[model samples]
Structures are given as structure tokens and as C-alpha cells.
Target chain A: MNPAAPRPAEPSASAQAVTELLERSRALTTPALRAAVGRLAPPMDTVAAYHFGWIDADGRPTEADSGKAVRPALALLSAEAAGAAAEVGVPGAVAVELVHNFSLLHDDLMDGDEQRRHRDTVWKVHGPAQAILVGDALFALAGELILAAGDDATAARAARRLAAASRQLIDGQAQDIAFEHRERVSVDECLTMEGNKTGALLACAASIGAVLGGADERLADALDTYGRHLGLAFQAVDDLLGIWGDPRSTGKLTWSDLRQRKKSLPVVAAMAADGPAAGRLTALLTADAKKSREEFEDFDEAEFAARAALIEEAGGRQWTADEARRQYDTAVGALAGVELPAATRERLTALADFVVVRSK
Target chain B: MNPAAPRPAEPSASAQAVTELLERSRALTTPALRAAVGRLAPPMDTVAAYHFGWIDADGRPTEADSGKAVRPALALLSAEAAGAAAEVGVPGAVAVELVHNFSLLHDDLMDGDEQRRHRDTVWKVHGPAQAILVGDALFALAGELILAAGDDATAARAARRLAAASRQLIDGQAQDIAFEHRERVSVDECLTMEGNKTGALLACAASIGAVLGGADERLADALDTYGRHLGLAFQAVDDLLGIWGDPRSTGKLTWSDLRQRKKSLPVVAAMAADGPAAGRLTALLTADAKKSREEFEDFDEAEFAARAALIEEAGGRQWTADEARRQYDTAVGALAGVELPAATRERLTALADFVVVRSK
Candidate 1:
């Protein structure tokens, strides 16, 4: 659990191979995303460009970090798994990335998150109305990209998959918001919400590429299952980091999730632990609720530290870490059922490691 | 300009014909829209059902009036003009209606409108965040509806048209929001904004049906032009009613546009008049600005009445009325070269008249 603890090293050959593939995937897909977004009219286009960190607020082009392009990498890999060239799946990759960013844009506005990636969010800079519309434009563009992909049946099939994922994503988002108002949220509900929020799009990303690459329905389903488990693992690991990871490395505030009282996996797991730690955690949260909203903003640093320590002591930290590993193994096992090229299978396995391990 | 005044009568035959067609179109398309929306997951689907007035807040099925389904009628008519069966355009009709409602859901939230159609807005009934997500789900469903229609080529083309229109719609909405902060907005600018906001979707509805019905590119373009002109006429007439028409019939507050200081067509025309009446209107509006936000909410009825009188005196009311009729004529004229059936042409013409001459 300690940050400085040593971890086992990955087999160097596959690790370097996947790293190369990921970089190459980004190289091909970033331009495709830019082209897709360029189809939008100004101000929305400009807002999107700013949100993607391709430009400054004033519309001047700037070279800034966009993101990991993880969804696109998964998409390209899935295409390769289907025995097709990755270029054939560029449209699918773009759609998945756009949907991911669309969710981020709306989530930032809805959550009133002023800063993302150490910069002002689109809503914060351009205002909520513009942010809302630009998000809609990106969503529309994502659908359009898939609809325009290739032949009719394939494009329609791909769009259908994307649409279903989008609906689930929205449903998941609504549930998450609704859950905030409830007095008690069960672990099952939390997991289902996570599946909808984080897992649906990733599953779509994984399967859509395969579908477009001419994979049969069963193989695409397998990949979707793999991605779903991978998404759960990724969220689990993220929850662990929220509690115990170094703020300097994570680029977030200390105990950021606790400060916001986010019902993340670790927090939920600890709440359901039924131990004295859960009792203390509940009392602390309830007492914190009596504070005014402004008081919550200036949450006590020592209280947050205490809460994190309690969650760790309740075994939530360990449980979630183990769950992440379990999901990661299951995800990797999913790839074995499909007849993929040896290189593709190795890359996928390495990508699974990259998601769960977090330690380089 | 008075609400109680009588208007010129429409030819009974065409009016009856178009009315029957609109009813038939709604009968065919409403079920399809409901079915499409039903495909979305619960909670999102429930919110959408509430938005469509199909259900109440308690999730009980209720007999509520949906809107006029004007976009669907236009779609069906365009298909008929293209020598296709109305049934062939049902998917396009459903898609347009979905997109229209999507805009309404978002617009209501953005504008903080509390009521619509004598019922609470979705955001008021549920929550803003839920309303936003439901709007998104509906939007995704709209694209999926088109993509999954009948054949690949037609569906893709229709989806592309809808996507382009959606972008313009967002642009129009952004401009409308931005215009609220401006000291002066030109009539031309107002028209363009309305074109993007109102006309774009209507134009897409008109053309997409024809395109899906196998109309040639030129014919589809003609229908699009017709719908754009008709949308402008519709908005112009609606603007006139916003100030001078009876709130009882309009289902809005008295002098609603003036109360909100909305730069509707009449307001922009009066602002650009450069006459004594315009000067008086400016002085009154400037004085209104001195009032606090709460004071604006408690605006004096006499002051609103005086603003309306000043706009009418500045020739704004008459200019907009004439413009609406002029646009209606131009829209009807657009059908002249399309070689539509005489009955279809008459119905389209009658629909144009109905848009501009909204006596009720």
C-alpha cells in the first residue's frame, strides 16, 4: 500500500511492444479526432479545441497534453484482435474518444468542477450554456462519424452499438446523481452505476472496433465483456489511488475523494464493512453534513486523514486492490477465448497490466 | 394587432385536408416516437416520457397533450412530395420529433423555464442534471432511429442531415444566449440566429424525409429551403404574438418577451428603427435596466404595456407581421418548381398559411 514499495517488473519485450502500439495508435487516431471535430462550426469547434487543450481560450493554437487516449488504444487493439488493420477502426476510435470527452464536459459542468487537468474547464471558461451545447455537438459528431464509416450494414451496426452504450452511459449518470440524494446506497447499486458510467463506453469502444473489423457477434461480445471487466478494474484502482496515492503523483488534492464525500468504491466498501471503522466513518460523514456548504469546502485536513486511515483499517483499501487485480485477470482471460494473433494477445495482456498496475 | 380581431379565412378544403394530414401523421408517428423512447433504459426513459407528456411525475401513464407535431407533419408532407408513401418517412418523422424535443428539454433547462404546456418542465419536475441526461439519451435515440431505419444509404444520409442541423441548432442557441448580454443586436443577426435555432431542425426534417423517400438532391434542397423560410415566418409571427397577442391563447405570460427583454424579431426591428418611438423604447428599457434583478421579476404591467405600445408605434409590429406574410409567400413559392402533386402542393401551402396565421 505504500507508495515507495517495489513491484514486479513486466516482461520487457511485450511491455515495449504495447507501448509502441499505443503511441502508434495515438498517432493515427488523434488526427482522425481532429478531423471529426473540425466538421463542427465555430465557437463549438473552438470550445472543443480548447477543451482538448489544442488551443488557448483566445483561439491561438497551443501544444498541450490532451489525454492518455486509452479508449482509442483499446479500440485499435480490438481491431487488431479481429485480424483487421487498425486504420479500419479509426472511426470507431474517434466516436469512443468523443463520447468520453462529451461525458467529461457535461460531468464537469454538472459537478461544478472548475478545474480539470490543472486548467479551467470549458464550462468555467466559456460558461455552462456553451459547455452544454459543445458537449451536444461532440455527441452528435460521434454518431455522425460512426454513421459515415463504411458500408451501410457495418456503419448501422456500429452506430447501434454506440447508441446503446450512450443510453446506458446517460442512465448510469442519472443513477449516480440520484444516488447522491439517497440515504443509503448499496454496493450492488454502486457497482451497477459504475458499470453504466465508466464501463459502458469502454465496452462499446472495445466491441465497436471489432464489429467494424468484421468480427462476428460472439467475438465482439467477448471483447465487450473483457472491456467491461477492465473498466471495473480501472475504477477500482482509481478509487484506491483516491484514498492512498500521493497527491503529487495523482495531481489531486490530498484525500480529494473524501473531501468531496464521493461514494467511490473504497468508501462504499468501507461503509458496507460493518466494522467499528464503518461506524466511525458514518458518524464523521454525518457530522460533516451538519456543516454549512461553505464549511464543507474548507474541510478539516486532519479529519480527512482520519477518515482515510479508517477506510484503510476497515480493509476497504485492501479489498478494492484485490478486486482490481481479480477483474484485471478476468479481463485478460477473456482475450484467450477469441482466436487473436499472438502479438495482439500479448499487447492486450500488457494493456491490462498498464491499467491495473499503475506502477511503471 | 389586437387578439380579438378577426382574420382572413383560409380555403376550407385545403385547411381541412392539411388538418387531416397532420392528424394522420401524428397518429402514425407518435407511436413510433414512444416506441423509440421506450427502448432507452428506465429513469432516462421515465424522464423522457414525462418530457413528452406521456407520463406524470409519479410515473403513471397520463393522457397529456404533446405539441403540434409540426415537424413530423412537414416530414411526412415532404415525403409525399417526393412521390413516396407517408409510411416510408415515419422513421424520419420520429427522428425529427425526437431532435426537436431534445432541443426543448435542454433549452428549457438552460432558460430556467418552470412551465411548458401548462405542466412543469422536466428540470422542474425531476432535476436539471437528469433533464440534461434524458435530453442526451433522446438525442442519441434520434440518431439511432435514423441509422436503423430501413436501408443503409438512406439512413446514413438522413443521419448526416440531422447531425448538421443539430450543430446549427446548437450554434443558434449559443448565439441566442450570447445575444442576451449584448446592448444591441441587429435584426439581421436576430433572423440568422432564429434561422439556426428554429429553422435548421425544421429544414432538416423537411429535407431528410424527401431524401429518405428517394427524392433527388435538387428536390430535397428545395424542400429544405421551403422549411427554412417557413421557420423564419413561424418565428416572426410568434414574436409578434409575444408582445401583442393574448397570453391566454399563447399559453405564456403577458408581454413575456418584453418582460424577459428577449431580443425577438419585433424588439430587434424596433431597436434598429432609428425613430422617436425607438428612442422612447430605448429610454424605457434603459430605465428598466436600473432596476435590480428582483425588481425585474416584479416588473410593472403598465411598463410592459407601454413597451409593447412603443414597439408597435415604432413600426416594429407591422414590419414583423408583413415580414411573416412575405416569408410565408416565399416558402409556398419554393414548391412551385418541385413538381409535387397538386394535393401535396395545396397541403404544403395551407400549412404555410397555418404557420403565419395562428389565430389561436
Candidate 2:
């Protein structure tokens, strides 16, 4: 049930392709990347090192448990799907991964949660000020990395897209902080916020692949849309699993969204309720500190179960997940439209499936 | 009496050229930079507007303050000193000025400052998160701005110098922060820290200009040293004025550093307790809250007289100002060493003098 173990795709041909796709990503992040990453700013040198599991908390070299480089994998796969090889996307892949890690470090701090990827969050270990600077340094380095790629035109366009994405992300983060103070959350409202928070960078990731793969603006835009959909689906599924899945399996505590009063998709959807469970949940939440941790825990246990039922009843969760799956499928389908090698197309489709079906 | 009025300079031929040199920096910024700042990211867009006084607290457009654009002036002047025309250093000028403002915004926030350039600080209105983000966006834009410049090699070199200086500045800031937690200070420590905190960027300003102006690396390095000296001198003079000058003339609260217990140059120099004044001052600071505002105000009323007497006793203020002037002259002399048009050389010399003598 642990999400950390490397998963094998089924014995089917598609599964073998996905396994190869994953391997391609892993292989592409070769020894040269370690040398390249060494040239990054010290702030990121440390943060990236830690995030990649090159070193443990005491600065010792544990070199274990960095998350699957999913974004980079997608980038490489998309490049292959566009008929270019993985080498074309390698530099851009590193940049995309740096951006992804940068987001994780900052978002973890902003959200005030402790754990990330089965370890203490950067802020928990480094403190917020250092963590914030680390994130900033990483962000700067990410843009710099993108700027360092191939030709004048390619690097310039990539840098522009990356900078625009970075700005949108800051705006999205501002909205999230604002969200904490508001009383009501609508489905559409959170959707836009989620899109900015998650969708923007994913879109950029896809665009980067297309750009490196030599796709034109039209195809890049399509890839961008594909990435956007994939990101939305990824976050929605993540939110779903957070409140329902086994902690041991997901490596995240269940009912954490409700316990933390996080403005997640289901929570926002559940707030629109007008029935018995809704009243009970609202009164329980509003009733205050008189509610014991045991009581609150008990409430969350039943409430999330009811909330899951309510999500189904409202057609909200199903629709969102369906939309997410649709995006995933479309993202995979978009590969077919681009001129690509058969092996590359097959691998990309499998990677897309592997992303959604990820238990963690 | 107007803070805006130009300070009188020595009537040398070089001095006569100063006004025109200063004017050229303004020429570089206004129309050209008007379009540039408009395109910055939000936290940065708002900040670029704020630093330039194009917008107010509510994000509404207001009259622009046109901050003398000193950093840009320094850069362009360095280029001029090195025989490069205005067009040659335009991007460096804009980029350095932007960086200068970025640092100012962050420094003001951490210092709990409420005002800047006779206007409310960005953080005083937009809050710290936005302020932090604004500084960050400016940093990003600063890097991007370099790319839009003279040639690929020059742009790359400027970026390298800038990014390196940025790391040094952060290190300096961290050291400055460390100085606060430990209740000790000395003249040497103050000078080095201030050199890093303020002087580094000022030095970079001149260096960027020189590099862009096609000054040789050795000459650029010399200008950097010269600029650092000027920066230190400028800061020392500013500290003196901050404590004793008329608020109307300085556009800052009298004894502002004393009131805030800021570890400014004079305070650092005086911490050696060269006389009874140092001891009494230290006692007053440590027991600051116990003192009546009237007592502090009376000390303020007597500050110019007290500071003059104490500085004379310690030979502190005179030594610092003399040291500053020495550096300023050295910086200007480096430009003289460069082959230059006599008039352009004169303007740079004049600009150096202007930097030391400006009231606000």
C-alpha cells in the first residue's frame, strides 16, 4: 500500500511502455545533472539536495526518498511524443523539476504543514525565513536554468513563459492566503484558484516539452491545455485521497483537510450542502473549543464519510474526477496529434495513466 | 531649503560637467523606463510604481517622485567615465536602479520603517508578503533586463556579476542581522557590513556601467572598489545627517537611527566608548524605554551640539566623512584613468561630487 515503492505497470504492453517511460526519465537525470545542480545557488543547493534526498536532516548523506520526478518524466515523454529524443528536453526537464521543488518548499511553509514526501518540511528544519529565501533562490535559479537552454529564440521564449507562470503562481498564493479569512467557498471559485495554483506551472511544463520538441505555437498551446487539465485532475484526486485514503498508503494523514479547515475541493463542495449532515458539520465546526480533540476527531471521522457521500450526492466529486480523467485522457490523446515515434507515444500515454492512478 | 534643490559643487571644469551627467541618467530613465516598469510583475509592478512614485498605497496612480535615479546615474556615469555613451549603458542603468529599489523595499520592511522618500514604504501599505514578493519580482525582472542589453557576452557577464553581488548582499544582511542579536559593534565591523549592505550594489552599479561601456575587467574592478568607497562615504554622511540634520532638510525624522536603536555607522563607531558620550549613549539606548520622550527630545534638541562635540572628541564623524571623500575622489580618479572625452570625464567627476553632497 506504500506509495514510495516503484510501481510496475501491469504485464500488458502498455504497462511495459510506462515502465520504460519512467526509466527514461530516471536515466535522463544522470550524473551530469548532479554536476549541473552543483552550480545552482547555495540556497537551492541545500534545498534541492534535501528534497532530492541526497542528504538527510543532520546534513548526512542519506540519498534516499526523493519523490518520483513525475513532471520531468512528463516533459521527456512529451518531447519523445513530439518526435524529438529525451536529450532535447533534458535541460528543460531539470528546470521544470526545480520549479516543482521550489513550489513544494514554499507551499509547505505557507500551508504550515510539517511533513512532505515522508520527511519534515524544509521550514520545519530550516525555519520559515531561511525556507522562504531558499524558495526564492530556487525560484530565481529555476528561471535561470530555463534561460540557459539552447538558442536565443528557444531560451527567450521559455524564460518568458516561465516568468509569466511564476507571476501567476504568486498571485495564486495570494488568493490562497486570502481564502483562509473568507467564510464561504464556492465550487467555481476554488476551481479558478486551483487552476492558478496547480494548473499554471503544469501548463508551462507541457509547453516546455513542446518547445524543446520543436512544436509550433499551436501545438504548444494544445500541450499547455493538456498540462493544465492534468494538473487540475492531479490536485483534485490528491484532495480526494487526502480525506479518504489510508495514511499508511498515501503517506498523508486522512481527514487532514477538514481538521486543518483547508479550503479543498470537497470541503468547498460540502459547504454548499443544505441537509442534515451539513447542519451537523456546520454546528460542530462553529461550536468552538468546547469540542474535544477526541470529539473533533470523532466528528471528522463521521463527517468526512458523510462528506464523501455528499460529494457523490451533489455530483461534484464525480464531475471533478471525471473532468480530471477527461483531462488525463486528453493529455494522453494530445500526444497522438503531434508527430511522434510509436514507442514515445505509447510511453507518454502510460505515464499519464501512472500519474492519476498514483496512490500517493 | 528645498530638498530638491541641487547642492553646490566646487567650480572645477569637471564640476561644471556634473549637472549634464546627472541629467543624462534622468534622460535614460523616464521615457525609456516608463514603458519598462509598466511591464513588471504585480508585486514588482506595484513596487516599481511605488519606488518610482507612480502609484500610491491603494495601487492608484499618483505623481511620480523620480528618485534622482542615483544608481543608474552611477552606472551610466561609470560608463561615461570609461568613454561609453549613454546608449551603451542604458540597460545596466535601468537594471541597477531597479535592483537598488528592490533592496530598499526589503531593507525598509525588515527595519520596520514606515516611510521612504517622503512617502509611505511599500510594506507600510501593501504589507510584508507583497513587499517580499515585490522585491523578488524585481530581482527576476532585473535578471531579465540584463538580457535585453548590449551583447550576449556583456549581458551574461552582467548577470554573473549581479547574481554574485546578490549572494554577497544576502550574506551581508545575514551578518547585519547577526550583529543585532549580539550586542556588540565596532567601527571596522560597521564599515564592512555597510559596504556589503549598501556599498555592494552601488559598486555593482558603477561596475555594470563600466562593463557595458566596454571598460576592461581590471578597470571595471577598480571602479567597483571606487563605487564601494563612495557608497560607504555616502552612507556615513547619511548616518550623520540622519541623527543631526533638520528633518525638513533631510526628509527624515531627526535622530531616527537613535530612536530606532539602529546599528548605523556613527552608532557603531561610538560603541567603542571613546568618551563619556559613548557610555552615556549606550546607557540611554539600553534603558531607552525608561527615558521620557521629553528627555530624548531634549537630547535631540541638543543632538547637533552633542554630536558635534562627541564626534570631535572621538574624531569619529570627521574621519568617516574624510574617508568617504577620499573614496569618492578615488572612484572619480579611476574614470579619469580611462581614456575619455574631457567633457564626459568632467560630468562623471561632477556626478561623484553630487553623490556626496545631495541632501535628500
Candidate 3:
């Protein structure tokens, strides 16, 4: 540290701007999201309401924690960057949110996740059949919402982007499932899978606003690249939190990812590392498989915590943290090629920083 | 007696025309369907290929039993009815076939069905996770294929119809699930569910070609009506087959739907009959429920056969047969309102007849 340099002030201007933008975006996007979901069939409508944390399992209205609305915010912000009214991007925001929820609903079922947002997942509360169908409904509704936009050209372009992204998202999910049964997954393969599973949707969300706002292809593509990198950074941060974050903050059980033996980015990278720690970690994983099924089932929280520590010792934690920073920087750099409004650029930079820095 | 009445020729003119139409439609539509599915990412692409019986689970190219391609034929025929060449409806055909496969994939998972089209279902072969994902991929691809059509209006209209039908289909599936837990379901409710589950997609298929062909709303809607009633007739025939069908011809085990205790139309109607036979059927059902879980599990084919006989004795078989004919008549009546080429009209009539009479 430079002895002459003063400490930065608290509540930095960028942080304040991001917080306000998130707040404003959510305020506008939520209503549109709700309206779009309301168009689902009654069965899906009920499950979706519960899944979105807008209602309790009994169908009574309740306030529960929902997601941060980052993708929707990106859609609206991208529209603003293209010099269009943010309100014009509301449908795009709604479409992205719907697609996001569709993936969440189906992914939770496929992954057998029991809890989300500190509440029972839709599959747990409503059952897997309903969860599956509602997910399908939401996927269809996402397209319907985009087509609801008045201009045929805009709707067609937005729908095409979403359809392409969804195909990539499903492919990514298939790859993820396949990776589970595999003993080895290359770091490159993992990154590509993550790009498709997470990055594709975010890229679509970012480009949707531009497509709807009639931005030129170059600017839209640039924004999409920015979002893809941002998504990579976001996922890396999520992987770190999965292993190290407090359960209370993360809304999951202690060492949840470790207990499930999820081949998350950091773990995959560490497993591929050429070091004693990597060998030891591999031995531990193989040893667990060799144990009696009952023994594997009886493994405790302490064992999971130890596995997390061992992963960190293998250099995974630091590697992923550094990777997150690199991706964040690259994402921010992509914005430089496009001439966005000053405020839009500031908000986007803040968003990129937020993706890597959030606690949960 | 009508012994003096002459028997009609076996292969009626309409039947001959429809057979030729179906064959021609398949030749055109299969290529388009293949192209659309080819766009899916790997894993899903592979599973989907297996599901469509184009390949084996080991990815070897093998011929397998696929569905009758009825929906695609209806789509192309309807396009012809609306004064467009069959080639003009290929996209609509592809879209309907994709959606049909999507439903089959998900429904197999939900129902825990082990076999389809004389082979292991996708869920059984590729695992449920991949089946679910591949279904999702097909659904997305369906939308993409429709939107890939050059005209914005046609794409938007076709996409909107598909989205609406998907919503209804999901709702019907939910109702079918709900009906399983109930002691009794009325005939009206069963009809409505069947209409949604089967009719909605068929209606969309029938109307899509017309919509894309720029047919007037009145003619388009009439064809849709025709398709809906045909679907109802088809379901009624399916219920009849569930209890009385020959296993060899149906490609299913003896009384398969009865073994599963599906609340098929005939069963629901029989349960509501005002007769002593209905009382006996009710007693049989209650007796099955009253037995211990082990005792229920011990019941064998004889018991299932007895139950089927009782249902038939209760007049379910006769009522459903009559209802199928009623719906078939109504479907044909709807077609009479729409002007069409004689060949197209003959093909449509043959299709409606075929739906009610198909053995598998």
C-alpha cells in the first residue's frame, strides 16, 4: 500500500449506483414478470406463484426471498445502453426472467434439490410432475411474452435470440448431467459447459434489449460478449460460495456442494491440477466410492467440511478467485468497444463488479 | 336383417387417398423433422435420435418403430385443404411432430412407463434426466422451426397457436395426475381433460398449416374444430382399446391401461352408470382398495381380466364405442362446412375415420 494514499470512502459511488439500479430494475421488472406468469394455465400459475416466492404452498400470498433479478436488470440496462427507453425493455426483461425460472424449476427437479430461497422447492412442495410441466409452461410463456411485443420484427429477433440461447442452455444441462457419471472432465470442457449453461442465457438477456431496441448487430454482439464473460465470473463466484460461504447467507446446508460431490469449476480445476493436493483429493474421492454404500451414506458434516478444506489446499480456491477476477476484468473490457451512454457504462461496470464481489 | 344390403368395398376411395396422402406427407415431413432435430446439441441430439427410433441407445444407426406421424399428416393435409401445396406446410408438420414427441417424452417419465413404440422409452433408455432435457430441446426446436419460416405474420401466428396449445396440454396433464388420487371423476371432467391433453395439440396441428397458408379465419377455425373432435374420438377409441385390445396388435401387454388403473373415459363413464353392473364394478374397485398393500400386489392377470369384464358388463365398452362414433360424426360434420379440393376433403375424411379405428 502507498503510505500517502488515503483509504477509499465507504458507499463508493459505483456501489451506490448499482444498488439503486438493481432496486429500480426490480421494481419495474417484477410487475411485468408477474403479468407474464399470470398468462400460464391455472395449474402452472399456482406452482409458478409458489416457486417465485409470491405465494405460500397453501396458495396464500406471502413475501419470500426471490432472486436478485440480475439478468432482467441486464436486459433493461442493455436497452438503456442502446439509447432506448428502459420501459421498452420490460417485455424483454420479463421474457428473460421467465426463461431463468424455467431453467431453475427443471434444474432443481433434475438435481433433486430440496430447497431454494430458504423454502421448499417446487418439486418438493408441488411434486415433480407439476414442476416439470410448469417449467415447460414457463419456457413456452417466455416466447409468448416476447411475441406479445407489438413490432413483429422486434418480437421475431428477440424470440430467435431466446430460442437459440435456450437450446444452448439445454445442451449445457445435458453436458452437466453427463459429467456427473464421468471420472474425468477437462477444465476446457467444464468451461464450455458452464458457458452454455449459464453464459448463454445471460448473453441472451443482454442482447434481447438491444434486439428489441433496434441496436446494430455489432453493438448487440459486443454486449452479448460482455454478458457471457460476466456470467462466467458470476458462476466462479457462486462456486466459491458453494464451498466456503455461510449457510445462513447462501440459503443452503453446510458444505452442500461438497456433500453432493458437485464437479463445480474450482473442484474440477483442482482435480486437474498437477500437485500432491490434487492426487490426495482424487484419492479421497475414489476411496469414498470404494467404501460400502452405507458408509458413503453415513458420511457426516465434518467429512464434508474437511473435503472443502482439502479443495482449498489444492489451490482450487485461489485459482477460481483469480479466474473470477480475470473474467470480470475481461467482461468490463468488452464494454469499451461499444460506445454506450456514460451512465449505462458506469452501471454495467458496477454490475460486473457486483457479480464477483457479492457474498451470496 | 339387412342381408340384401351389399357390403362396401374394403379399401374405400377415401382410405386409399388418405394412405397415399400419409405416405407422401411422411416422405416430405420426415426430412424437415430430421433437419429441425439435427439442430439440437449433442447428448440431447443423441437421446432424441433414439427416442424418434432413428438410432439405438449405443448411437448405432438402426431402424426402429416410430409413431404413425398422424399429426404431421393432418398438418399437411389441412394445408392442402386451405389451397396450398403440401410443401408449404412442412414447417408446420415439423413443429407438430416435435411437440408430440416432447409430450410423449415427458408423459413417459411422469407415468413411469417403460415401453413406447415397441421399444424402451427414452427415459428408460437414456435415463430420466436426459429424457426431460431432450424433450425440452425438442420443444424449443419446434418454436425455432416455426419462427424460421420467412413471413413474420405466419411465424408469429403459428408460434402463438403452439404456445396456447402447450399451455392447455400442460393443464390437461395436471388434471390427469389429479384424477389419479380421486375416488371418482365425472365423465364431463374426463372429456375436458382428454380434450386438452389430446385435442389441443391436434387442433393446433390442423390449424397451423391453414394459418401459415394464409387461409381465412373461418376455414382455419373449422379445421381446428374438426381436429379437436377427431382427437376426442381418438381418445375414446384408445380407452376402448385399453380394456379390450389384443396385445399382439396393440404392441402392449394385456389390458395395460387397466393394470395401471388409468381413469380412462370408459372407466369413468362405467363408474357413473345407473345399473347393477356399475354396483358390481364399484364393489370390485373398493375390494381392491380394502385389501392390504401386499394383498393388492398379489392380484394377478385373472383379477385384471375380471375387472375388465365387469367394466364391459357395466356398459362402459358400449357407451365409449358409441361416443367414439358420435365424436367421429361430429368431426366429419365440421369438415363439411369448409370448402376444399375433393382430394383434400377425401383425405381429411379418411384421417378422421382412421383415428377412431386404428389398432395401435
Best by DockQ: 3
Where is model 3 more than 4 Å wrong at Cα? A1-11, A36-43, A58-60, A253-255, A271-315, B1-10, B57-60, B279-315
TM-score of each model, in listed order:
0.88, 0.74, 0.90
Superior candidate under lDDT, 2 versus 3: 3
Which residue pairs in candidate 3 have backbone atoms (N, alpha carbon, C) closer than 3 angstroms, thus clashing? none
True contacts kept of 3: 0.59
DockQ of candidate 2?
0.18
Q: Is candidate 1 or candidate 2 better by TM-score?
A: 1
Off by over 4 Å in 1: A1-22, A35-42, A56-64, A79-85, A210-219, A270-315, B1-9, B39-42, B55-64, B79-85, B210-219, B271-310, B339-342
lDDT of the candidates, in the order given: 0.82, 0.67, 0.83
The local lDDT score (0 to 100) that residue A317 gets in candidate 3 is 84
| Candidate 2: tens digits of C-alpha lDDT, residues A229-341 | 77777777777677665777777767666676667776676657667656655554455335555766666466666656655565555555665676676666665566667
Docking class of 1: medium
**Residue A85, candidate 2: C-alpha displacement in angstroms:** 8.4
DockQ, candidate 3, comes to 0.56
DockQ for candidate 1 = 0.50
What TM-score, to 2 decimals, does candidate 3 have?
0.90
Cα miss at B350, model 1 (Å)?
A: 2.4
Scored against the true structure, residue A23 in model 2 reaches a CA lDDT of 70
Worst 10 residues of 3 chain B by lDDT: B1-10
lDDT of 3 by residue, A148-221 (tens): 77577777778888888888888899889888777778888988998999999999888889878888889888
